[model samples]
Target: MSCYNHSNPSSFLLMGIPRLEATHFWIAFPFCAMYIVALLGNFTLLFVIMTEPKLHHHTSLDLLIYYFLCMLAGIDLVLTTSTMPKILRIFWFHSHEIVFKCCVVQMFFIRSLSAMESGVLLAMAFDLYVSICKPLRYTTILTNAIIAKIGLAVFMWGIGLMTPLTCTVSRLLFCGPRVISHSYCEHMAVVKLACGDITLNYVYGIMAANFVVGSDSIFIAISYILILRAVLSLSSRDEGLKSFSTCGSHVCVILVFYTPVLFSSYMQHWGQNIPTRIHILLADLYLLVPPMLNPIIYSMKTKQIRGQVLRPFYQKTEVRINFY
Candidate 1:
């Protein structure tokens, strides 16, 4: 029996934004700024949801939506954190070396968190569908217990789907030239370095992407279709428009989250002539852009959240007005 040789390669050098080594310092600033915005926006949204009593006891449906939002915020944080810090280090300090085990761990977290974010978006879609279509039974249909169960299932689904991929990659023997061509340890990027056959890894990766992301997107589309149908059936045109508008923010978020992802996936397989720098930029945007924009989209579109966000400013304004 031939034992697997895990000691042949111990680390990997991440090539950040290929061919742009002379300007890594210039690139790091924007990336760092995006990271700060994502962190502050997500944390502020979470704080408003948790601390504001007005936000807490609004409606049963609102509460349910809040739960999903919390889950999403947490997932976005995990997803970005898994890659951005290491990416910053790579670009800023020229610290490109990452231990193999650490690389595997980062890849696992990034994939799993992205999958979980998809699940959370699906859950949010269901929430929107119920609130719009089955308004009468929204609370009964999605009770606290059911919401808890859904969150648990989404979490487990992500972990379960990514476990096999992580395990498979961990077992592979990596030879020399252990350099990853992207800013982070992406699954396929890491797998490409393996000395052994990667057929199983590729097969499993395709299956997982189809099963998790594809299925979630299909369900979200169906939910939105049903929601639109229900909204259009309303007697008052204005009311119908209002109901449809509620989903505008979610639709924007969905577009922002999935557009780059789909593009990146296509580029990965078919965009052979695409520049490596462009591919790496797309990959970074896939992780960073959604987290940075989701909170802003919601705050601007959702009156409830926006109200909470501006309450202090409004109060101070009123105080000044009264003093005058």
Candidate 2:
């Protein structure tokens, strides 16, 4: 796909954390902190899951956790890489111009990552339902082989679904006033600058959101309904409690991930009065905060994971201190 041949602007300004005076140290501080935290948190989760024998237990629930963690790592990279470089440019030179190619790449990668997140969440909901509703067949349904197959399918679907939409966007002509209204080259922000007709792109964008966001959310809701029905049928209180607790964390995470997506999608499609600042803030939180929060939330409630993963790190640090 080729960017529309239009006169390039001198530079683009990022309106980040509004009203704060842009100072080198002040601006770089938050970006650096968020990037490091996202990296360390997702890395720890992935490392523990890969290395710990306890986490290697062959269970339907464990497979779901591992799937979500892998998705979260991808998200962490996508979120930080998409915008942090721009933040650094602002700190160093007060502003920067994104080459046409760089802008298209940013837009594609960001949307693709967010769309892929919805896929992962839907897969997780299916995993939960199978574990609860069909316990007898879960071993057969969610084996290592099946989990690997599902993961590959979800990623492939993410790629197939996003490629064309982003390609369409790349063809649009971007003219003067390249100053993006927000920190990143969001799909809509870049497309809006196009001097040419974006009607087809808009149509495809809505369709993508409907299939990726709407369909995933509906499936998740249905999966939970089935899970709830199965839990209610259980006569034992202990069994019901365990099921509820296990699903509660996942439900919370799903809400965090999807609510903002639907909010932005709705405003774009239906024409809402939501302010740009509010929309941008929510979008950033949706992309950035979730990656940091998921690993923390999972580690807190999952006792086996906590003990097997976090405890070993602490024990190792203590051993080093004693030797010193």
Candidate 3:
């Protein structure tokens, strides 16, 4: 049962989707397609934001919104890339072996990026709150320097919080049965395989989740509540609806991102009878669904992004007609 070797501590195997060997290849098709969509969609959104001069010419408040949107797109890219490749390989090629160091790296990026995304969403909520509640002071409140500081703070908060958890997991001695039950390397999944005491690991994991995800969710809720009140107080009903419409895309993205995550976390803790396959499926959706849908949601709901995305095609048609 001695799995650890002092000479090579980085060896481990990933056991992906147990008891589905016959359907692995068939299952991989959809997963691969989703991964491709996530990558292309996020990258396309990033490109549009970075390239569109109109998007950058906005006031400080608008710029902050664009910045957070760009940050969210980047986070979605990293988050999905961290886990999907490994998961796809497991299903498509039966390559379940992942080194311990690699596993640690994947877990770090996935968890850190996720926390950062949550932070970014919270920041977006605040941005919307300012825009809707105090439009006049929006530029004054969120200056360029302040926006930069907020971005830095979000990055630091995620990295700082996840570092201890990663280090703690790395220090544990994993013994025997190096096979991870899930498709990717997750903190809890990896730690559960270790032979050493994991009380601190579990405690720190819970605390990190509460501090990062929990706090972000709470603040987002508060921001929306105040936003709702502000909208309600507006003189015109149409104006109120118009103001609330601005957050529709963000609300959709948040639900897509958090619902599966919260459910998976709950099931892990309380639903002991749930099948491992169900857990794995939820984990995959938690990572994959948001990235795939965020760009589509924003493009459809946000007029500016939609126009920018379509402007090039329209211009091409105009050029053809003028030439003809």
Q: Candidate 1, residues 1-324: lDDT per residue as tens digits? A: 232345547789999989989998898999999999999999989999999888887889778877888888888888899899999998889999998878888988988888898898999999999888998998899999999999999999999989888888888878758889999998888888888899999889878877877899999999999988898789999989888788898899889988888788768767989998999888998888999999999889878889999989999999999999
Q: Per-residue error at 81 for model 2, in Å? A: 2.7
* Alpha carbon deviation, residue 7, candidate 2 (Å): 7.5
- Span of ten consecutive residues with least summed lDDT in model 3: 1-10
Q: Which is better, 1 or 3, measured by lDDT? A: 1
lDDT of 3: 0.85
- Please provide, for model 2 over 28-59, each residue's C-alpha lDDT reduced to its tens digit, 9 standing for 90 to 100: 66666766777777788778777877666666
Q: Worst lDDT window (10 residues) for model 1? A: 1-10
Ranking by TM-score: 1, 3, 2
Clashing pairs in 3: 10-100
The list of candidate 3 runs beyond 4 A from truth reads 1-8, 315-324
Top lDDT hit: 1
In model 2, residue pairs whose N, Cα or C atoms come closer than 3 Å (at least 3 residues apart or on different chains), thus clashing, are none
Question: Model 1's lDDT to the true fold?
Answer: 0.88
- CA RMSD for every model? 2.1, 3.3, 3.0
Instruction: Tell me the lDDT of model 1 at 53.
Output: 88
